[model samples]
Target: MKTGIIGAMHEEILLLKKDIQRLKTEQFGSREFHSGTIDGKEVVMALSGWGKVAAASTATTLINHYQVDQLVFIGLAGSIQAQLHIGDIVVANQLIQHDVDLSRLEHFPEVKSPFWKDFSFKVLPQSEDKALQAVETFLANLKKGDYPAISKEYAPQVHLGAIGTGDQFIASKDGKMRINERFPQILCTEMEGAAIAQVGADYQIPCTVIRVISDKADEQAHDAFAEFLFENISNISVEIAKLIL
Candidate 1:
């Protein structure tokens, strides 16, 4: 089966590209596609850049142009829950757009657009059971020698839960705490997963997100992100690709 992989930043995609043998390059609507293989699994991959629109457009291209059967979004996220630390993995069971707000019309919390009323979108209707199971299975069965490149004593902890996606980078402690309080079910927050999830749902294609916790919601987050992400992202990507493929 053909699988499409998308990363939100150039740094996230660079290592994966190094391992893959680039077979061809194609362009669709100003976006470039790189066809390749990862761990002997035939795949097409690209960096979707930073936010919702870019992610959605890339997902659409992966489905319509690349003709991939499944899509996997692998990247980093900020830990919303206090217990989660840098390097933990979060497999999204559901995705929420924290920025999607329309509480002005004497109504309960629900999605709304300026032009439309009561329009809401729910991501991952079934809670991504198969993908979550795969992640759990992989984590449970991983061997120390399986990946020597990563120095962590144990395989990363994989939590199956809600992942909030929005356009803003979650660098503020107050904002992070507020979101956690409002959406107690959420474990992590990132920029692109939900948008891609929405597009995948629209096209009826299976999609899953695997996010590595890069920082906790605190002042240390800003200080530690660059070094933490550079060291962990590639390793995280390899593990997620193994589970998905």
Candidate 2:
């Protein structure tokens, strides 16, 4: 099976690009596509940049242009739940667009505005229990020693829960607290996961988002990102590859 991997930032895609051997590069809609093998599995990958529009367009292109059977969005997110710390991994069991509103429509009560009456979004069901179990099992066996080139402990604690997506970058403590109070079950917040999920659902392709916590919704988020990203991003990418490949 051919799998497509999408990451929204250069940092998230760097390791995957480096790991690609026998790569063939192509472009469609100004986006670069790298097709290659990782762990003997056929893969096509791209960095979709930030935000909902960018993510949705890239996902569509991946499906139409590359003909991938499945997609995995891997990246970093800020923790909305206070207990979630940096380096923890979150596999979105479901995703929501906290910013979408269209309450005026009776049939789509989830939305809250007349303008958004025709803007209902899509949702990808959580991958089957066996797939999730396999991911968790691989994460459990990941070790820092296994990746000698990488520094810091590569321990990952996986949380399966709601992940909220929006176009805005979440760095405020007050905003984080407010969102947490409103969606208490949400585990993380990011800019692109839900958008990708919507496109995957439209195409009837299985999709899953695996994110590593790079911040905890505070000023320290900026201070900690460089360290957290450098130490854990590649390890997380490798873990995702192992699970699917």
lDDT of 2: 0.76
Clashes of each: 0, 8
Which lDDT tens digits does candidate 2 get at residues 16-100?
7777779999888778999998878889998899899999998999899888888778888999887788888787778777667
TM-score of each: 0.85, 0.86
Q: Name the weakest run of 10 consecutive residues (lDDT summed) in model 2.
A: 114-123
Q: List, residue by residue over 1-245, the lDDT tens digit for candidate 1.
A: 78888998876764666667757777777667788876677898877889999999999999998889888888888999987888788877777877776556556556445453422234454436666776676566455356666665645777878889888888888989888877888898888988887887778887788888888856777766787777767766766565677
- TM-score attained by model 2: 0.86
